[model samples]
Target: MRKSLLLFGFALALLSCNKEQAAGGKEFKTAYVDTYKLLEESEEMKDFTNKAKVKEGELSRELQQKAKELQLDAASFESEARVKGMQWAQLKQQELQKRQRDLGIMQETFREEFDKEFGVKRDTIVSQMRKFIKDYGKKNGYDYIYGTGEAATVLYAREGYDITKKLIKELNEKYKAQASKEEPAKKEEKN
Candidate 1:
């Protein structure tokens, strides 16, 4: 739904820009791209996903070791003992299942955290880009500004029009500044 609106708006922006340009002596140029998708494609998201996978592997290994320790067998295996063994196996299976469930919950929590942090970081970066674009457009006589995201109707855009690299660059700068400020505040609160 969000992507659809963005695409529709993008088409409208282009049409509006062209209409305004043709109707008057104005020349309007606009472009749209999804900043979030670009960020997800970045190495940072890959690194985060890799870390989560490693953690899951470690958890699985630990659970396996635990299961081995608990996989005990009695010397005189009677009918009752066999039934007890079956019950023990069932309980062990449940324990393994619970561990998997916990691991899944942890992974979900990490993904949510990553998404939230990425969203904030992307928003900050986009905000900085928007400021620059606004100033640039105003000075260059641009009449309208549009945001590009997953659902923008723009099937294709020129490389020159893609401000993604510029936005990403500006975002890292903005993120570092914000992180620096936040770190000092965190340190002070801890003290």
Candidate 2:
């Protein structure tokens, strides 16, 4: 009778522990976003890409024009050097060298400026997106939101958990509202 009672007590303890464990285990809500799709479809990103292209084209055109002018100057110098004395030719050659150096400096300066501006803008946009996502998660009661794309952090998630389309729609709407607000300010500045 004593052995049977001990065995029953042990079984009861085990059942109670199992019940406690089951009660403590809670399921968390999680979702994922396709980062590549977000960036590719977002209005702000598209606008930035278009503006960057235009800026690059402008810089390239400026450089090409400078190069063409340099070529013409070189041709003129060559003709003048053929008709002039050695001393005049030497002076003209030095001047042409100086102009070539200036053109190189300008090209380097333009490249550096373009890179710096775009880098800052890119960083800003990414920071804004991260903040937006964090806010979205909190607002929507998500315990966790993973990012998936080229640098995918979440490799496998259920299709139902993908929130890329929803995020893109909200993000574009925010961008459009911000742009509209800025347009009035920009027009005011013009006036």
Candidate 3:
């Protein structure tokens, strides 16, 4: 009887504490951003994509021209080799082989260089975006900021809870400010 009374008293105290806590329940503020929309609508992203495309096209054209030139040279060498003596033809063939090897190495090196530079640029952009979102969430008193993309990790979010536009606007403003600041520095360096 004594143990049962003690247990009942403890249970009553727990119930009272729960009632007090329930009166002061905390509500979490959460928001989600459409990551794909963010990237698509971002001015900085558009500029970067445009610049990258132009550079890629130029590089591809240069590479293709180099390949075409090499092909033409090989064809010319082959035509000459038939008329030339066997010994001369052998020497020319070896020279053409060396040139082909060199071209392959050059192409490989160019691809690696372009990929490394582009990858670094892409990674930097993503890192900056993540940092900006984290800081934005903290500044706005958000408990959780989730990212939803084409893959649809967040199946559904209310329109009011979608912060993609505001976030992209802030990001673009920052990017423009930074770009303007850097442009003068670039001109000064060039001079």
Question: How do the predictions measure up, each by TM-score?
Answer: 0.40, 0.62, 0.62
lDDT of 1 by residue, 1-191 (tens): 98777667667867677556644575656554455675568575566567756766766676566555444322233444456688776765666567667656766675676567656765675566556666766576554455556433433333446788999999999999999999999999999
Computed on alpha carbons, the lDDT of every model, listed in order, comes to 0.61, 0.79, 0.74
The 10-residue segment with the lowest total lDDT in model 2: 14-23
Q: Candidate 2 on 1-191: residue-level lDDT in tens?
A: 97667656654653454344223474455666778899899999999999999999999999999999989988998788889978999998898899999999999999999999998998899789878887887777665566756553543334556899999999999999999999999999999
Model 1 scores a C-alpha lDDT of: 0.61
Q: After superposition, how far is residue 173 of candidate 3 from its true place, in Å?
A: 47
Error of 3 at 82 (Å): 1.2
Decide which is better by TM-score, 1 or 2. 2
Model 3 per-residue lDDT tens digits across residues 142-190 = 6556565644343233355579999999999999999999999999999
The total number of steric clashes, by the backbone 3 Å criterion, in model 1 comes to: 6
Q: What's the alpha carbon RMSD for model 2?
A: 19.2
Candidate 3 Cα deviation (angstroms), residue 18: 24
Which candidate, 1 or 3, has the higher TM-score? Answer: 3
